[model samples]
Target: MTEIDVATKAPESNATEQPAEPIESSPAAGPAVGEHCVTDRPTPAGQVSTGEIIKINDVEVYVSKPADYPHAPARFLLLLTGGTGLKSINNQLQADNFASEGFLVAMPDLFNGDPAPNTTTFASQEESQSLIDAFKLRIVETAKSFQIDMWLARQTEEKVLPILHKVIDGCRDEFADAIKHGDGIYAVGYCIGGRYVLLLGSDAQPTTPGPERPADEEAGETKTGPLIKVGAVAHAASVTPKDFASLRVPVSLACVENDALFPDDVRVAGEDVMSQANLEHEVRVYPGVPHGFAVVGVYEDATIRGAQATAYEQMLSWINEH
Candidate 1:
């Protein structure tokens, strides 16, 4: 399989009164309200049939369920959006592959509210720095705050984790019967989203630093949640050392050999953090893949494909074991 590389990054919420009139329910024949129903598209094999688009907590989220499967319903997967956003080629390929494997996939549009244009060319380091500055400014000005404890409680009690809960609940409501009979759920992410998977697993509390410590360290210590048996896969991104110190669940990190975003020394440092934490984790570097190799088929090398498949299979085994 081709090799790939990834870099780590830092990584939102809200509530409002609902007084609007309700819209009429879909006029189609299907399961009753709150029941999980099959919401497959009528497309030919190997093609994705668009599923449902729903408003969760005022955020528009798109959900896709597998077309068909004969196995018992005991497993589900949630695909989080990466740095390039939901419309990126890599995100789409991962979503389709997982859905085709009978896993429920949810791709939330994290950049939906922003007006940033998707561009590939950068004139210089100054331009890249400017873009980063703009992104940070926007996040500081627009992100929401939620009760950390309350959100964590919902993970086990409601079978839905925060951030993810809204999207999953929307899916369950739309396809209630299918989810009701389905197995537990898992989450996977790439790049920015990968960092989030670590954040969610660590259950870190959001707070400003007290005084002496660095700004990033001022964020409160990680909070533990009820063991929900979640298996998260993060590719090319590294978790903050302090955050990794608090993780209690099993997680895996896949590193790409040729990723310019994350250098070999940086990757080793990340692995060291995981080692110090003594957390059940694995970090494997693919020989010749570039960053985003797993999600993007940019390299057709056999080595890249094999590595991607191996990562997927390992994740499945971990999820199943849990």
Candidate 2:
């Protein structure tokens, strides 16, 4: 199988051309947690391995188009990676998987090149009494090393939103020109990345950051909105109920039972909030799994493997239906 290597001509931050929509420079409040998924990820079957890495200002973005890229029309998919950053094997695999699913995928280095350490490793089978215990140890190790509170301060919503906005603007400009009429934009966030994706979807109207643009640029066409039309998250971290308000866009949540970042109380509250938000939303629980189950979870366990596969399928189903 050959790889599809193509770089997106993502615009520079201070590009002269105005963005499709104004990106606001607001930081998300609260202690956002990062799920450090550190397991090895083999490329999926029939996946077009290797995506292009494009540099836009200070950020590095991994771009992956569908297997039959350039030949077939497809929707744009923005993938948000967890604490391990964009280059993590799992993240790369995730991008390729989405691309194989016929999406033009763009995964930016959320940590700007400096990703957190891969601290999530299980103890030896001999050391741990049971398989589940081994998996639990990895979860604890990851939590301790990440110091998520500190990481949040450094990469708050304020700092990260601007970068994402820039990427979204660039993607909209570059891909929309691919065909006469481009398809809609969608987003799927894993663990830490989920918080940012939710923030972008909540706003009824999100403006671009920096200076005010002219009226013609301010006007947003329904199809050309840089904001994600549909959003999905798997075992997300640091998402508050206030952020949930079901959001303005369609959303689907894949949650795990053993997640500290998103406890049972928070999950129930979020479900209630979304239930009343009057928006299209779905929240499904995966029992007996950890926070990173959807991304870099231990596939050895039958339960974990099954949940992981279903979570990924749910992500695809959400986008397809909505």
Candidate 3:
């Protein structure tokens, strides 16, 4: 399992005083706990095989490969993580499912070997402060290792993007021979990972520009990589309006009607932002479901599982279309 050092932001006093609501109940009945059901079979393209971990910058990423060996070059599906890390049980299962569909899935560990606390269970404010400060210091040091300008951006992006670029580059280099045979590359993300997918689509640094732009001009758009065909899946998490305005790829936001973190109004606000941005996007809410409903085992409710299956089907359809 992949472990991530979770940074606990200080809880606001007002937030602490408020009580969290109960979990929402869903209408659709779903599979029971420990039930392993294969709703869809792999489309005749190939079988799925696990790939070895490869390092991109300081981060270690696990990959899944196609079994039948594509006659053409292989495309990739980059899996992003949420607040928690990629080793979550649900994430592993989702990765396995995608791999079975013949897409090379890359799961990067963003918080390994760091001083950040694994959980935010600190009892005292002082203790939490000390831990957070220490974690920030570690982040600064890590940024220095990559020669990145930490002052300019958040630690997560500063730490993550370089490694992501490296992985994309490595994929191209390692599979250059196969790529020459004509397979395409694509990306997908979930939660924070979903956000990264948007970043990679609109802001990835270009290592190589296809025929349209000169190599020198490409650097001017350092954050914009060659338009690699991409699709993104943003679950319960919401994107800021300004950021939504900049989205340049096909994306989908799946929301649960009763999500505690993002209720219907919040989700609608996010959807509105996307609409204003004029980006190709869609927002669908499953009635009576809660946040993390798509994740199997965590909720352990039949209704949640049913909603999850429906969401999975939606994602699969989007992926196939793109």
Best model per TM-score: 2
- Residue-wise C-alpha lDDT for candidate 1, range 118-178, written one tens digit per residue: 2222223453457779887556434311222232222221122344555665655655555
Collision count for each candidate, in order = 27, 8, 5
Give the per-residue lDDT of model 2 (tens digit) for 180-250.
23356789998778877887786533344444644554342112332777888887876766666426777
Model 1 vs truth, CA RMSD: 16.7
Best by the lDDT measure: 2
Model 2 regions lying over 4 Å from their true place: 1-48, 123-148, 177-182, 204-226, 296-298
**lDDT (Cα, tens digit) per residue for candidate 3, span 1-322:** 1211111112132233333332222333211111011112122233333465677654677766666656534556767655444445455556767766767677776445332222221123454557779889678656543432221123355566666777677767665554443344556565546556666656434343346665556442454543345465635343333334335666666665555444455455545544444445656666665455554333445666677787777676666676
Estimate candidate 2's alpha-carbon lDDT, on a 0 to 1 scale. Answer: 0.68
Clashing pairs in 2: 22-207, 22-208, 23-207, 23-208, 23-209, 27-157, 27-158, 28-157
| Model 1 per-residue lDDT at 252 | 63
Per-model RMSD to reference: 16.7, 11.4, 14.8
Over 4 Å off in model 1, which ranges? 1-49, 69-74, 121-184, 207-228, 298-302
